[model samples]
Target: MEKQTSANKPHIMTIPYPYQGHMNPMLQFSKRLASKGVQITILATNDVKTSKLAHTSSINIEYISYEIEQGDEIPKSVAAGLGYVNHKVLKRVPGIIEKHKASGSPIKVIVYDSLIHGALELAHKLGLRGASLFTQTCAVCSVYYHVQRGSLALPLEGHTVSLPSIPVLEIEDLPSLVQAHDRLYPGLLEVIKKQFVDLEKAEWIFFNVFDKLEEEIAKWLSSQWPIKTIGPSIPSMFLDKRLPDDRDYGLNLFKPDAEACIKWLSAKATGSVVYVSFGSVANLAQNHMDELAWGLLNSNINFLWVVRETEQNKLPGNFKAEASEKGLVVSWCPQLEVLAHKAVGSFMTHCGWNSTLEALSLGMPMLVMPQWADQTTNAKYVVDVWQTGVWVKARDKEIFTREDITNRIKDVMDGAKGEELRVNAIKWKEQAVEAMSEGGSSDKNIDEFISKVISTTT
Candidate 1:
């Protein structure tokens, strides 16, 4: 083991892409590094309100805020908003780095989210090492790399492509970013394409996944660049052994309605409640919301659904009155806590990687309904590879009916099929736990990453 000194200790600056999903994983990784004696500075965008500072008992971790000017009119889609933020962040990077360097804690390395490609150029200007932290699954990264290599084509609509390590996927299974009809399609596609360009310039790349889950893809990616698998980037409370007091990522953009949801779950029967959430970015049309509400009501089962505060008005009229007896709706809830509850038997999700991992780690079966981006790919893995969940198809590639939702929920919660899924979910949960344990693959990978950082600085 190496002893640390103020001058030689690895001081890392980590910047996520200014979104909830991206920020959570980056923050978790920073905490894990801080626990190992590294000093970490987390950079957050001013557009979103976040805690100015977060300190562990050791006080090695700190948060710094930077501002990105916003226009009066908001962007209508997630991809557009991401593009806006990414551009703003790039413009401010050089100044942000200079200011930090003048303050005496010069950054030795920068670990940036893959979406912010401009960081690589900034790193070059400052003569600092740069690494990319991809918050999505390894499979998506492999796919994107091939697309950059000219092996796969964009606007791959109505075509089936097979990759070396991943399952064969239809164009429909690809991210919605490539669709011409998507409002943000062109901007999002360009961003992803440029990401691979900047990826080649990074000193190393890190994936928020484990080797066992994407063994083939992980091996393939290593041939291209220095890569490490250091994830299932969950809270320490859920998987790793940590100080009793080190509990949250403390980076949530939305305040959780944890107490109310927990009380409702306490009154329900074990394995009887359905947990529904679409993650932080996706938005549902009013018709789709109506269908979802009616479907949950029609099933006559207890459900806890999370609708964003902005979208609450989109719910069907009298929905609260009609479903109050059986369903509980909240703007947001403490998801991991809710899923870990014994009362949660199944999940209805948008198949975001974070949400997917949380449900699998808790041994809960899922009804996967992916909306856009890497979520479609995640849905494919949930249904075909893991066999721990069922996929719900939308009619005419638009909206799925209320009946479709009802039947999917009933099939997973009532039939022999449901029992098999439950067994598989429990098996994956055990595997995840084993991976995060002391000698497991994820644990070793993190240790290796820390050692590499220390050696480089020394």
Candidate 2:
């Protein structure tokens, strides 16, 4: 084991593209890096500033807020796409960087989000060290690379393309998210390719995935470019193993909702209740929510759902009704504590990286309902590789159809395969913990990664 040291005590600026998933991982990465002597500054847009999140700790690292000057000339959609609000914000960063250098907080390196391609050009122009923090997994990165090289094209509109190299996935039963049609966003892919052209500008590339989880593909990635596998980056610094492990608190964020729903699980027996949550950001249409409402009603299983503001639709006003006495519905609750609870036998989730990791970490079986973005990719791993979940495709878009809604949830909760998935989910959970422990793959990569990126700051 390596002792903490001050070798990496050079100033590092982390600029994440504006988004929850991207921002969260970079913050956690910098937090851990700062703990080991790295001086990190998280750069956020002035409009979508990270001012409140700046660590006010006694650590030597500093966080600076710089605004991309806002202007009225650009349309709302165009500004988001261009990564600028007003021309001022784009024009000001270089000046800000120069000022920082003048102030003696000389940036030894700049860590930019891969999605922000323009930042690469700006970094080179300013003469600073730089790296690209890819918030997606190595597999997704490989798909982007292979697609760029012409080895693959997104499957034709109606067909599926087979990726034989991906382990645990068969050609005949290809995971829905990995399938050809309805894959990759047409507009976003174009933006990504242009940004990737700036790959040569980066000093290093870091991915949000682990060695044990994607070893083969990660190795393949390293062959083409300087790559680091350091992921499953949940703000896991929060977990306390010293506490009693009764389990089933469910999945959640920095705050724990342990008391909020653990009581609901108390009355239910193990392997009897199903939990459904699609994460904080994703929302299905009202009809879909209604369909899901009735689906839960028909499943003959006791279920708990956490519906957010966006998922609002007129379901039976007291949808949880007599079941309200039996079922629980809340706009939001602590997720991890619920997942860890004793009564949560299964989870129907949105397949986000954090959720997937929590499910795998807790050894809880899942029913994957990927909404969009990396969720599709996450679902593939859950249902295909981990053998811990079932993928529920949104085949019938009319989410109002009671029959489709009820049957999908039913398939996830009570199929003959659910029990097998439960056993495997637990085994993977242990493996996940081991991967983060001493000499674990995640621990090794975190050490190795700092050396490759922030360590050279001086």
RMSD of every candidate to native, in Å, equals 2.9, 4.9
Each model's C-alpha lDDT?
0.79, 0.64
Positional deviation of residue 212's Cα in model 2 after best superposition, in angstroms? 1.8
Assess every candidate by TM-score: 0.91, 0.80
lDDT of 1 at 208: 86
Indicate which candidate wins on lDDT: 1
TM-score of 2: 0.80
Candidate 1 Cα deviation (angstroms), residue 370: 0.8
**Runs in model 1 lying further than 4 Å from the true structure:** 1-8, 46-84, 91-104, 179-184, 394-398
**How much is 260 displaced in model 2, in angstroms?**
3.0
The model with the greatest TM-score is 1
Candidate 1 lDDT tens digits, 393-437:
552456788898899888888878889999999888887878777
